[model samples]
Target: MMHNATYMGSVSSVSSSSIIIELAESMGSGIVIIEGKNYRIGQVGSFIKIPIGYNQLYGVTSESNESSTHDVEIIESRSRRWIRVELIGEMIGGEFDRGISEYPSIGDDAHIVVDRDLKQIFGQPTAGQFTIGKLSSSDGIDVSLDLDRLVTRHSAILGSTGSGKSTSTASIIRSIVTNNDDVRLPSARILLIDIHGEYESALGDIAKVFSVLPDSKNPLYIPYWCISPENLIDFLCGNISEAYKTLYLDKAIEEKKKAIKTNNIKDFPTESVTTSTPLPYRIKNIWHELYYDDTVTWKEKEHINAAYAKDGEGDAENLIPPKFLPPATSSNPPFKGGNNLVKRQLEQMKSRLLDSQYSFLLKPGPWTPDKDGKIEKDLDQLLADWLGHDQPITILDLSGMPSSRLSLLLGSILDILFESSIWGKNLKTGMRNRPLLVVLEEAHRYLSKKEDGLAKQMVQRIAKEGRKFGIGAMVVSQRPSEIDETILSQCGTIIALRINNATDRGIVKSAMSEGLAGIIDSLPVLRTGEAIIVGESAKLPTRCRISLLPPNKYPNSRDPAVTASWTQDRTPENYEALVSAWRNQEITKEEK
Candidate 1:
């Protein structure tokens, strides 16, 4: 059926499932015709299959020659070029006949087969979608990801410090926002939690940049005071107090009773309230009131006139007079509890609440609590502001905040989105249709392999099950080994750039399917901007030069060569004068 089946090479090298076919002579044609089909068998991403024994061996045409010599790295042995693959499995029975034998000698016959079908493997997404990578070889080096994958599935652009990871992330995001035709995701919701505030200028055009204190012009407003009390405590204090805990549970029960009463449900218990309820706003309000509002305390009105003063020294602690107590209790009771444990707990809670930084959180304005410790504002509005807003990109710049709470803050936001999306089912009625993608930069700082952070938990859930619910996570980190294996293993696609660390390389190896191990071994040597893509989303794992992102739109990641600049003989003499001139211009304008 097909001709030109030349004896190009032989199986000079063999592994478990494949052999390296060394060409008798080198052939340098850019395009190779194999099995009656023309394929662009160029460098990096191209592959060819040759008959080995009973099974066929697959190899990417890494080196092609016009003469008789060439080198091909084996991918897999198959009957057809199309690799309908699962994962690693055992090879069954096979034997070599006289016609197919000879064990691939130096001059044995070998021919390139048709290019592996990528479109068939991954299938075309929507019309506007662009392919990212593919799962082709064992190395898990070549794969494709769609715009849908980049935006919705959540992606992490991870690599070492000098690996051009940021540029790769920017390039992919830009392609999604700018390149698509039919299905422009103009309203696509993306939140980049900027830890170092590095991406404001880079992603300004496509994203809403949020910055801190001095950069007040950025409209990112996360009112810490507005976060519900229970979440606030979990985020800031790490744990809640016993008395405040009791108060919080009481508030929740009371709120529940009110809701039931309004709906005309008669039976409601007055006692046995516990602090483990899911009603966030009610608990938040109780914490707020107990910690703040010195005016509400009976001790505030203690008679400090001459009667409370002893030896001209006033005791603020024991100065609570009869007039300051509640009317019925003060008139009837002498002493009940041996020691005021509840009172002591309340005092401690009050002190923590009254501190300047914490005070703001206790009674944050616009999200104030009612007299009965109920939040006045609705939670739906908060949800909409978070995910359903008009802007596609929302940057939660945490530059001003202390690093200690960064992980918790990020985690709370993630938890809210994930829980709401999964439990909030009806799109036609409530908040369900739009899915959120959270890109965690510097993930190692929060999510690690050994320790569990809230971000890691939610991220793992999204990675494993978010697709069904329209939620996904992308973990971007410099240290991949520091991240949890469960999350990394669940990733449907991986875009591994140049990695130098042996430990990091080992971790990547562990995550990939076994057949692709050799491809990954070449990782440390990969050039900048070159990557190996592998996963279910790709047709074949092929090494290819990723298209470079535009300089203006890219992150400011490249370090300057200071030594080269210093070595230059010529230097600008008017550098100080230039600065003075700019200062003079500013002074003149202010004088005018």
Candidate 2:
């Protein structure tokens, strides 16, 4: 057993969840060697123990300071060093559990926690635990997380740029998906929304990669008809008056009804259909009908609607006469008015149709309708392609997509998943039976509080109620301050890397427990790949150095070597290929 010589201080004050200790003069400001073992004294985020009879209480040192009493005799004056520690847990009968049944009284002895006590506090690796990293103070002690709370209760990973955020994310995902004898979580399903396509190369062998370019065998496509009416309008029409919106909705419903009748799909009731219904309809046909209403003219005398303006003799109006004949004049005029309300909408629709960048949504193979207003494929095929794959991880690579359409695209994808999970809750393949973890990278771009886009709404919904339905979200971002407070608060566990900005640190600190203020203050100085984990999934609030992955397993997020690139000779052939890629809107020629 450890002796009283190892004791460094006595508790000066006690609270419900914290204790303040005044250090002894002999153990001030540096490492204290006890029994030839070097033990660091009174550091922020380090642990200390207080023994009260048979039970021992563990706490993390949150703040440390040295102060002197104001005395006139300066030669005889002395300073006292003290540390403020937040109580983490208590150990009884050699087993550690979070929460304290009894608080240590003032003047109780405080000792530095050693390796044996740390092993007991962290507990042994079991079936439900996965290693995240090693303890910061003791490099040899591994830190593990409970997988159950990590997935079902939700989590977040936040850091600054170049702080190993992506690498840590990849490590956590790899640990969960990799088949191991000790960890029993082998059948997990994870969906990763890769905003920059940095993860495909890192996890491709173990995951199924999907992209808009269709360069891979398994291409990704989100049919236009699968999106909600609100998002569709946001994509196709920038903005419109309420009157025009009503007109558009009526036409959309008419088109959807025509498609249902043509395809002979009776699963849905015809009378209950709305504009937001997920059904295939001919987009071209709707445009044609709207254009005709906007531009078609009629003969004034006949008072009959005509596809084209005609002359008094019922002949097509001739602007010019045959060679050498007198030029035609407008004797009987065409109708002076037409429905021009949809002119701007028609122009926007035309532009989107001609742009190849939107082909993934508008020109999805077999999902697009033919001239006869019928589709060869349905929503089931699209869902199967996204979620029914044999691989445990599915990566949706959005690097090739247009930046302007990112908000709409993200919202539509999440809506599809949310709706599917709700409807298929009872099925064997549903989310309830086989839970899903949807990882959203660069979440701040779409999930900001200033915007109420569909992506934000769906993510907020999943964060609030997803646990009961077996749906969990893992939000990854570099800016925690920009993320929605409601969504961030819903996360039961937080893995924070080095955050340097004051505003960002303040936001993160506000979300954490009050006792951990000192740990929060240490965010700016954390080393790369080191993180402070707190909340439900962790045994306690811990500062750990995340294990470094092999070069091959690291994410593709390294900065380019500036000097090396500048020194290399430039080739005309390389420039030509680069221009070709720029013109084609693709990353490489092979994507074509």
Candidate 3:
């Protein structure tokens, strides 16, 4: 017989997975001692063992009522005195396997799981086992997930602010890439999108950081020509009609044909090239030509020549508009036949080109092209800069970037990598051979359900088809409710932290499999760093406390110490420096 300490009650009733246990009246104590340790009775998310014949059925208590339960967020019910257990797996022939061949009889004995059973269930970490944390119910038990499935199938980390979402993310990633005597994965490729610039302090040691306003060895640059012309139109010419958009795209294709021939790209189908092809062309040159066409005047009824006021050729290099002769209202001669259809849009494009804040995208260093469509460097060099490093991780710090166009920029980055993956699938250097993990932090900023931005489209594409190309995405956000349902549903693993909002809780709950969502009720009250990990990567639905990252390795995401800042004595203000940093649109080296 098992230890008397393990006795909880007998199964009073049984359903397919949910079993109602009638608490043992003889054992009235709410806390029972087993092997010198006290285990709470019917604690939600704690494991329970039901013994029937030779199989030991293991289940997690989803709903349990106790008179003496007390916690930070209490959900105890006095009217309901029942313990509902959801069977998870079974132990047969000393091996743990999910599902059972036989069901537990109504009068079968239910035991509060002890250390021995937990150790059997969790097991020791082996190769491919990534330890996330200790089980919340049994701290001594380490909860590990299958690392292969996690990186291949995709995952999400979600929670409210200050709930330790970023910390847990940094910890899990660090655990994967951390070098030690036991393991050394120097080739592991993790690309983290640091939307708020919060991960550098946590992951800098193991990662190579790139930023638009760089304070490191790497300065981020995204070539404008690499952007899909449709996305470019959205950013440069907002609220444009479809007819103008088509014309704009056709112009880009024309420019691309010239670029492909001049750049001598090998085997490229210049004949079939569309606006989506990544071709290097001078954006200013295109803008100037388009504007000229819109505002040009004709000399005669034949529309031949010399309608320009005098030497009025605009400088495409300088974005100078030519002086044009006014169109005659009663046309015969000096008739300016220029349509002026896209004059406003061309001006807007020129303005964006002139803005210094967008220079990183417009006049990207090395990748920028001249009027002749020649560049100092090409996409190969740009990709090498991002991926060909000794470190296992690459952090794209997007803190100082324009949030208004974040979707287009992010989409361009993914498009570059995805297209490379597609074209290079047969090569040894492709993502299929080495694999890539893209971690999108603060994903809701661009992946909102309401917006149909390019970022969302590429993410959806990756979510649906990226696995075959060895590209995986991890969408981290505080608000799961606002994320697109299609993207959220495609995630195979969900690492949900404490979410206080009921609607957010519902989103997390719905993400879990129907059988496992029962324990998600405890989500709202989870302590910081505690999470319920479920799905393809998890061995079982486990309520685990995530391991704390090294103090120095925690993400720079802690709440401001308002009380301390208020209590401190006044210091000299530096509004001048503050204004300078704001105006320059950069986080300077000193501040970094």
**Local distance difference test, per candidate?**
0.52, 0.80, 0.83
**Between candidates 1 and 3, which one is better according to lDDT?**
3
Task: Report the lDDT tens digits of candidate 2 across residue range 453-493.
Answer: 77898999999989888889999999999999999999999
Alpha-carbon deviation at 554 in model 3, angstroms? 2.0
Whole-model lDDT, model 3? 0.83
In order of appearance, the predictions have TM-scores of 0.65, 0.90, 0.93
Q: Which regions in candidate 3 have their CA more than 4 angstroms from the true location?
A: 1-3, 65-81, 179-183, 214-216, 329-332, 515-518, 589-592
Comparing 1 and 2 by lDDT, which wins? Answer: 2
Identify the runs in model 1 with alpha carbons over 4 angstroms from their true place: 1-46, 50-128, 131-144, 147-155, 180-183, 211-247, 252-365, 368-377, 428-432, 556-592
Better of 2 and 3 by TM-score: 3
Candidate 1 structure quality by residue, lDDT tens digits, 309-388 = 23423222232311222222553422222223344444455454444333223444444444443444444555655565
Report the lDDT tens digits of candidate 3 across residue range 46-114.
Answer: 788988778899988877663333420132332324577888889987888877778888788889889
Q: What is the lDDT ranking, best to worst?
A: 3, 2, 1
Summing lDDT over every window of 10 consecutive residues in candidate 3, give the lowest-scoring window.
Answer: 71-80
For all predictions, the C-alpha RMSD in Å is 10.2, 5.1, 3.8
The candidate that achieves the highest TM-score relative to the unseen native structure: 3
